[model samples]
Target: MLLTDTHTHLYYETDDVKRAELVQRCKYNNIGRLFLPNVDAASVAMVYSLESSFPDLCYPMLGLHPCSVKENWEAELAAIKQAIHQHEIFAIGEIGIDLYWDKTFLAEQLQAFKQQIAWAKSLKLPIVIHCRDAFDEVYDVLLQEKGDDLRGIFHCFSGTVEQANKITDLGFYLGIGGVVTYKNAGLDKVVAQVSLNHLVLETDSPYLAPAPYRGKPNESSYLIYIAQKVAELHQTDLETVANITTENSKRIFGV
Candidate 1:
């Protein structure tokens, strides 16, 4: 069975030995494919380095993260756009509106989000969104840009079923991550109701680790736990979950 982690920042590890170990663990767990999304211009090299090291296993994406939107966002976006043209990326993301930490850059975030969406459309590539506490704001922008080319994954989705429906209806898939395995995250209930066709698996490593590894540093290898939880929620087996979600990833990344 081949499991796909549609969203992961495993490149953040930096340590060659530790990074290799993480990749080995993922392979051992049948997690064969991993898509890497760089948050900003500074992270582009890291993402490309990981993909270069494991060219067959890792796919790269470029974008400016909402959290990274600051006073110098215009320059950062220009640098990221230049990097995007230099490489063949699978998607343009881990981009969207984030209102969890601070709302000071709400206007900037909206502008950056819309600009990235246009980039994705122009390139005919899928996007991987990173929506936090700004679902309504993000969804509003998405609605404004709705089209055949406006499609991607809603990364690290921890929203309600209604939100899930809204995303799927727009031809985007819900990126199910470690939160689905949490006991009280309520994402499990939402996953149980959403069809597997509209769902994709992710770890968002170094961030939201699945249970047992929760509150600790996460890695791509832990994707198996999230997949297993999804399998249980969907009343299916691990292989089925792996097959479906991995196929869904292929559809989104086109790799």
Candidate 2:
């Protein structure tokens, strides 16, 4: 079965030993494609280098993460614009409102999110959003900027059925990750409610590892566990889950 880890931070590991092990395991599990997202200007080199090292196996997206928004957000966005022109970014992503950790930069986060959304539409590239405890705020911007050309994945979705429907209505895909495996996550019910056609699989590795490894660091190879959970939730086989989500990944990333 073919699998696509649409969101992973393979570059987060600077240790060669761990990196090599993770890469090998992903290969063994048939995770053919991995998408790396840029966090900020500081992460640009690492993300690009990872994709450069594994051009065939990995893809990269350029954007300022909501959590990374700070005082000098304009400078960061400027750097992103320059990089977008210089690099072959698969998407403009890992961008959205993240009000969970710090609310001090709420204004900056909102501005950055809207600016990045404009960039995605201007570049005609898909976006990967990172919404956390700010679905309504994110939806407000998406609504204000709504257009036929705007599209992307709602990375690490943890919303209700109504929110899921609103997302699909905007031509966005729900990025289902390890959260669905949690007994009380209720993400399984969300998954069961949404069709496979609108779902995509992700690991968000080095974080949010599925059950059996819930509290531990996540890795791309562990995507198999998330896939198995999705299969069970959909009342289907693993290969079916793999095939459908793989196609959804390809459809969005065009990779």
Candidate 3:
């Protein structure tokens, strides 16, 4: 039962002891691969450091997150581009529209998303998107940027069946996470509607922990619960869910 955490923020761990513990827990839970998504210049170093420390388990991605988009976003994007050249990034991601927190940077966020999408296409790498309270906005940009070259995961997807179909139709995978296990997230219904082939597993660690651990600090090891919930939703076994989503993750990250 080899599971892959398609999205995690191991860099968020500050202490060496906790980081080591997290790695051991993930190993015990059969989480063999963890994809780390970069937020911006501030997080690039730590993201790369974690990947460097666990070359076999952690793979790093480069991009500018929407929430980080501000007046000086151009400089941040430039820094991200420079970092990409310096590091062997797996993808261009954790990037997209995020209007949940603030709308002050909506225009800048849109520009950053589009530019990052262009970077992904140019580099021939998949992108892991971070869409929040901006589905229509994200979909609009994706529609404009849709093409054979655009392929990636809609990270942490918690949308409706119609939205799920639209994302899958665009050749993007839906990143299923702890939200699927929530009491009334309705992600279970979405899971039932979308084929497993169009889905991948994620934890968004230090964020959305699965039920029984929801609202608590999430970790890669907890991916088991999310996988189990997905298995239940698909009416299959846990190993089946893990295998399929692991393969789907590999297809996207090419690892």
Ranking, TM-score, top scorer first: 1, 3, 2
Clash-forming residue pairs, model 1: none
Which tens-of-lDDT digit does each residue in 81-145 have in candidate 1?
99999989999998998898999999999999999999999999998898889999989998899
TM-score of 2: 0.98
Please write out the lDDT profile of model 2 over residues 1-255, one tens digit for every residue: 899999999899988787878999999998989999989988988988888777888899989999989999999999888888998988998999998999999999999998898888888889999999999999999899888879999999989999999999999999999999999889999899899999999999989999899999999999999999989888999999999999998889887
Question: 1-255, model 3: which lDDT tens digit per residue?
Answer: 899999999789978899999999999999999999988899999998898888999999989989899999999999989999998988998899998899999989998999999999999999999999999999999999999999999999999999999999999999999999988778898898889999999999999899899778999999999999989988999999989998888888787
Model 2 clashing residue pairs (backbone): none
Alpha-carbon runs more than 4 Å astray in model 2: none
lDDT of each: 0.93, 0.92, 0.92
Off by over 4 Å in 3: none
Error of 3 at 78 (Å): 0.8
Better of 2 and 3 by lDDT: 3
Higher-TM-score candidate of 2 and 3: 3
Query: Model 1's lDDT to the true fold?
Result: 0.93
